[model samples]
Target: MHFIHTNKSFLLISALIMAGLILQACGASPETTPQETPLAVQTELAGTEVSIVTHSFPASAISAQEARLSTIVMGTITMLDVNEGDRVSRGQVIARINDNQIRAQLMQIQAAKMQAAAGYELAAAAFRRITNLYEQESATRHELDEATAGYNMAKAQLEMLEASEQEVQEMLAYTVIRAPFEGVVSRKFMRAGDLAAPGQPVVTLSSPGLLKIRAHLPENLIRELTAGETIRYSVPAAGIEMDSVPLTRVNSSGDQMSRQFSAEAVLPDAHESGIRPGMFATLHLSISDEPAIFVPQSALVHRGQLTGLYAVTESGQAVLRWVRTGRAHEGRVEIVSGLRSGERYISVLDTPVRQGQRVSL
Candidate 1:
């Protein structure tokens, strides 16, 4: 009975060793196999509606005509009738200079004229007497000739004095500076007690009705804008609003330094709205027309120097497409390439997505 029990115990031990070998052959170690990773899912997004459009280079506002007022005659400025930003009319007095010297000279010329007139009268009386004497044969022919020469010289002297007086009067008028045209005085260059000289500026004025914008544009853009074409302008600082003003002129020649052509646009009643001369402005111009696709700025994704969008393929695959972009407006960006209209894009996606990976919509 003891020998039978020992054989049974050996058989049990052998069976247990065989079972352990089978478990190792099956590769059941926990360290060998990794845990399963979660798959990323992408959501379908409706593409933004885009419109075909054109764009152009921006422009700045400039003065169409700026005149610097100067004195035509030299004298001390005694009175200034207008201040800066004061409206003036044509022929209105803007300033006055001291005219005491000119007035005194005019008076002196008047006195000389009076003396010459008396001399002329006396000469005429003497000539008439000489004529009577010659007619009666009481005067020699030489004497009559002498009397005629004296009379003519006296008359010439009177005429010279009269011319001198007129000249003095005209010079005196120059002391009063008058507005050349109806405009607002944009600047005051001189003050009372200041000496004004010929060609020296006293005030600078601008015509409100003739207001316009001047800009320099690149040569390539010159062909895009033309005379009579309308453009828009705005002044945020001055709170002025304008639109569709006709372009008045364009210089075909480009600037030597900037290689840009000069352009101008006429503003309609800009002065009435307090749009002062020399105010800065912006100009918009259309340059060209080209076809392109666009998307909202919100749909863009950034990945370290790569700007792209999440796209969902027709077969429900996640794709990260790189794209080129153009101008942006109202939160929409132009997709110059790499996108098409009416295509489905993935705006939102589950984290850890990869390209060509199947994703649940």
Candidate 2:
């Protein structure tokens, strides 16, 4: 009990015990040999695959037959029978302008025509009387001449009035607007009661069934396209792709200002697929088909401004090799340079690694 109560003795005993533990740890050896397992990773051989390089240009779907429905006669729009998106047949009445003034003018012409006809009839009777009298030697030559001149003048006047009447009637026909072809109304600019003038459009009608793709190709690539050749196109918004669309037209004579030429392709199934005019489209012109090497995008490492990928050496070590990359497609990037065909490169990694680390396939 006295030995246990002494504080200096307890501290001295604790220090001696710690010193013995340290010495024993120093003298002991590992029971089983300590070993390092190689880091497991997957590897693949780099090789050339067929790569499709294309020059794509933005395009639009347009109606092959489009028209702006307008009236030649100026008047107030009295009737607009169709709205936007309304389907119309060829020669269908679309809109009408108030032709009350035209009708009034026509009535005035008709009255003048009647008066001229009455005068012509009277002149004809007088000329016939003069002819009979002159044949029977009962009239003077001067009187007959005067009667003949009056008949000719009256006949001319009557014919002139008839022409005027016809002119007014034709102008009346121009007040009614009609569709030139079967199509849908894309826009209605002048509604009912709106003032309409000549050359101003009342509605925009397009032949939706005759839809085609129109694109402006740059001058550099215009030589590669030709008429009657089938090309591939896509409507990204509609998720539609066409591979065998027949090219209807291509103009290599590039525009002077824009330095581009126009191209058009027939869309045979555009109506069925709900592709309408003014919808966006893309035209794909295949540039080349050659073997190009590609690397997995996941394996690319970016250290500041430099990009590198891990490659395996013959001695089974990971060496970080800097690579110049091109465009990325799908899940892989194009190896423009710094990598060769049939070379070994690291793929997806499970654990982070460093340069000179051992990798086992």
- The candidate maximizing lDDT is 2
Residues 10-85, candidate 1: write the lDDT tens digits: 9999999999999898877566776445355534344444453444444555445567777677889999978887
Find the candidate with the highest TM-score and give its number.
2
Candidate lDDT values, in order: 0.77, 0.88
Q: What lDDT score goes with residue 77 in model 1?
A: 92
- Per-residue C-alpha lDDT of model 2 across residues 1-361, encoded as one tens digit per residue: 7867798798999999999999999999969976656678888899987766677889999999899888888999998979899999999999889999999999999999999999999999999999999999999999999999999999999999999999998999999888988999999897899999989999999988888998998887777778887788998766786555878999857789999999999898788887878899998877545578888888888899999888998888889889999877668888888778888989776678788888888
Candidate 2 regions exceeding 4 Å error are 1-53, 251-255, 287-361
lDDT (0-100) at residue 180 of candidate 2? Answer: 88
lDDT of 1 at 202: 92
